[model samples]
Target: MATDSPHPTRKALRRNVLALLAVLAALLATLVSVSSASAAPTPTIVLVHGAFADSTGWDGVATRLSSKGYPVQRFDNPLRGPAHDSALLEKKLAAIDGPIVLVGHSYGGMVITNVDDPDVVANVYIAAFAPAQGEFVQGLLNPIVYPGSRLLPPALQVKVVDDPTGVAGRNLDGYIARPYFREVFAQDVSVATAADMFAHQKSAALVANLEPSGPASWTRVPSWYLVSGQDRVIPPALQRFMASRVAPGHTSEVGASHVSMVSHPAAVTAVIEKAATA
Candidate 1:
């Protein structure tokens, strides 16, 4: 007979169910907070390789950056000309949603320098050319000014093959010495890696579309420059001059060759990490 009056008990049961759901909601919110805390930060790095090289040249650097929890993409630059490459790089930079660290190697430096992307938080030049206003890549090279320069390889002259589309070319070795290649391209690389690089070397077309850069990107964006002490290609002095032009406070020197990113990845990665955080 007493069980017939179930209103109070049923109300209590509804309260219990509501309390249980409230507890579950709190637990779910806590779980979400924990998941958010444990989730890795999204880091985007765009690597632009230099002359006579493809996107694969950044394989070593990409691995190091990825190991540090960065999402990295290496742009396979046409190596055609500065204007064309810069346009391509700008398009790539536009596609990235978050802030990005633009790392340029050798001539790729010029490409990053010209890309006018606001999302680009930092520009990292790894033993690469950092051109300033009214400068061309050709101007960066000394005019056979030093004996050491003479020892380095001569610049390759790229010409398009006879095709209706006027694309493709024959890559003739441009008087580059094996020792010079070994020193500049494979200084930190193993003998085998160096050999492989040489075998895969592509002919980079002279940037005929290159014009005097009007305004410098380093001026607006923070920059980090990695100087290769033994860089025979651009000359260490040139790197210093370029770094100074930007007035980058975060300047570093590694006792490696022009391709130090491949040889001394740890050092290069340190600079990139710094740039990303900065």
Candidate 2:
């Protein structure tokens, strides 16, 4: 009898509950749509490794970037010559759909500088070699530039001689033959990791190529330079000189070896993050 007396009231309460749930569902859908629209697009980081090395050199750095929700790609340049390498890098840059940040380590720095892509928002130099107009790698390196260099283990020196390309020869087996890669390439890396790098290395002909970088993109694009104070490969002085030429909006120095990206990823990433946002 009581139920019969409250039948209409019960129906009304059920209707209210259903209506409330429908409203909630609609609100949730709206929220999802808004979130989708507001989410920031992930930045693309194209890593170009310097001579006598391949894409694997960027492994740890790539992993760190990926963890932070950034999409990363590594280029395997033929390393035949500067013109050829620059063309390859430009091809990769053309494929990117949106904003991009180009990172060059060691000789990779030179490669990025030669890439004539206008879409590149920022260039990040990580203890990388940045040459000036009409300058080549050889032009920037001299015995005085590298002092107290211990990263070039004797084993690596031997390998360079054995390498048929002459640029790396057998030395490609030891580590990066370039003074910069030897001194700073693994500054932040462990002995084990550095040794491992030596175990699997590729000889690059481009190292010996004296061809000048025709035109540098750094002249037009905003840039950042991360100088490794303890770098032995390219020399701290050369880094300073090159940085001054680029006139990057931001410049920082880290107590790392030439390969700061491998040794101090956090520091390298911090600079990259700034470049990406800028």
Candidate 3:
């Protein structure tokens, strides 16, 4: 007897998983916890992109969720800073009725946490920062900013610009310097891909980074966290600390860069779907 062997393709594997998920969803009503196995008709999944990125970065995750029959949408985060940006997010959330599973990547986590809308029943942090009360995005990046960070060459750098978004309402805007974007934020992506991501980055206002958060929404809403272990933008240690603060058994660690949601969409979507059903 001869055994047939062929290398499995990523697409083939994904299709298999999608099929399994569909079966599980069909049986969720009886075989599993309705809150955990469901892949549809639960809460809406909202994807929020962080700095040095646009909503397009969520394409992969959104596609996965869509394939699973889950309603998904990506919001264009105006990196106007936290308070103002969160307010804008609140407005967007207002347009989306019913329960929501808010998922944010990078700085977008700050915005979602700050929004804290009641409609948002759950939050998913995808290689994201979930700052505690009084914490700021810039403050978290200070180690990488001022130097002595563990990584050589320091993975990230920021620059201040005039309020280009117009929504910032502040004098200084913060942008991730393009020079290190590929190595820092999207290290898992290719040069050509990273270039496109860099080109589409939206700058956050400096005040947005300096502005401290109020009480965190995670404290009120159940949350899930996905930490990209190879992240250079926001140290992985910080990601773990934040994830620990969330509900236990709701955190996962994936080996990827800061932009893990793009590089590892399946992992990211699984977490979001978990939150949506939970």
RMSDs, each prediction? 7.4, 8.0, 14.4
Per residue, candidate 2 scores C-alpha lDDT tens digits across 1-278 of 34467889999999999999999999999999989866757669998887556777777788888888888988886665567778888988888887789998877887888888877888988777777778887677655665544434542343434544344344233345544443445656766777667555665553544768778888888889998888766688788778887755488899987767767878888888888877
Which pairs, if any, clash in model 1?
none
Full ranking by lDDT: 3, 1, 2
Task: Indicate the worst ten consecutive residues by lDDT in candidate 1.
Answer: 164-173
Whole-model alpha-carbon lDDT for candidate 2: 0.74
For 53-110, candidate 1 gives per-residue lDDT tens digits of: 6777787788988987898998987666666778888898788888888999987888
Residue-by-residue lDDT tens digits, candidate 3, 42-71: 678888888778998988888889999778
Off by over 4 Å in 3: 1-40, 142-170
lDDT values for all models: 0.76, 0.74, 0.79
TM-score (all chains, Cα) for each model: 0.76, 0.73, 0.78
What lDDT is reached at residue 12 by model 2? 99
Badly placed stretches (over 4 Å) of model 2 are 1-40, 144-188, 206-209
TM-score of candidate 2 against the unseen true structure: 0.73
Q: How close is candidate 1 to the true structure, as a TM-score?
A: 0.76
